[model samples]
Target: MHGPVSAAWLLVALCAATGAYCLLRMRSGVEEQRLSAGGEALMGFGMAVMAVPTAVFTPPRWAWPLYAAVFGAAALRTLWAVRAAPRHLHHLVGASAMVYMALAMAVAPPGPHHAHGGIGVPLLTGVLLAYFAGYVLLAGARLVPAAGSASGGGSTAAAGIRAGAAGWGDRPELARACRLSMGIGMVTMLLTM
Candidate 1:
């Protein structure tokens, strides 16, 4: 229940909630939205698992390899589907990050040694930070109401806002917020390592 652990748990809860919402949204048959929903669910769930406190349950030696393999498959799937849905490239990056973390943690020497490994932990951390930071910024921009639009009464802008509100009710915005939250979470986790 210390500050860092508390924050990590909060991130995990946020990710789980987002994943659940995305899965619910997938029930709707919109193909494009469904693709995004699926990616969000995967990202959320993966991050939640990654953020779990080691004290709560240290992953067994086999678990890390299994996780890496699963995420490796996910990365391949993302690459194959990237042409169909370009947003999946982001999913690929997230999955790749998971793979990197899994492998890094697996090979990392036990005990009080630094978190950096022989395989360029700093480089991996930098890449993840940049990707997540960009995602958060772009997603945040998408969530904001455009300037001079809110003031025009009954304009397309207003309609857009209404649509956004409806979308928020549907939880896409919430999912985006969760992504941003996860990005922050990942950065925090990386820094702590």
Candidate 2:
């Protein structure tokens, strides 16, 4: 595999791991937790399929339409869920991006000419880059205090964690991390394209 392909595979692995963790958390018998399990799994699998190295496997023409349909449905679901919580908007954006990528790939020329550039491509890349950069910076900032406290004393970290005591599904930090991971993956995919 080449550099971009290798990076995509690494992202696939991370997304899969995150999805697996979310699935495990869903087993806790919490209604709210269960609601997101499907979305997480879909996101993971969708990214994996999109990231597959073209050398290893180039999806057939029909597959692109299928992917577009699947991600379109996912986008709709995420939009519906946004009424429950604003955070679901991020998921909507992710699914929409997937749809965009799928459509782009569907119309792309075959062979080495598949990856091309234009004003639209650069615009999308810039927007995605800005969003992911902000997300990572904000999330990293929030984690800083936690890291500092944890470094000061292990018990302090434990105490902080215990006080929070949220179910894995409800963890803001983990959710942020997952979003960041997906953002990075999206950016990587876009750049390769």
State which candidate has the highest TM-score: 1
Worst 10 residues of 1 by lDDT: 165-174
lDDT of 2 by residue, 1-193 (tens): 1136677678779877776766665665556666776687688778877787777787888998899999999999899899889867877877887888888788877664445454355567568667766766776677555545556546553665688765556665665566566666766766666
Error of 2 at 86 (Å): 1.7
Error of 1 at 167 (Å): 6.7
Candidate 1 matches the true fold with a TM-score of: 0.81
TM-score of 2: 0.80
- The parts of candidate 1 lying over 4 Å away from their true place are 1-3, 112-114, 117-121, 154-172
Residue 21 lDDT in model 2?
Answer: 66
N/CA/C clash count, model 1: 0
lDDT of 1 by residue, 1-193 (tens): 1126677688789778877777776765456667677766777787778777766756677888998998899888889989776866777787888788888778876553445744555876787877777777887788786776667576563475677744432455565676676666666656556
Whole-model Cα lDDT of every candidate shown, in order: 0.71, 0.71
* Predicted structure 2: clash tally: 0
| Candidate 2 weakest lDDT stretch, 10 residues | 112-121
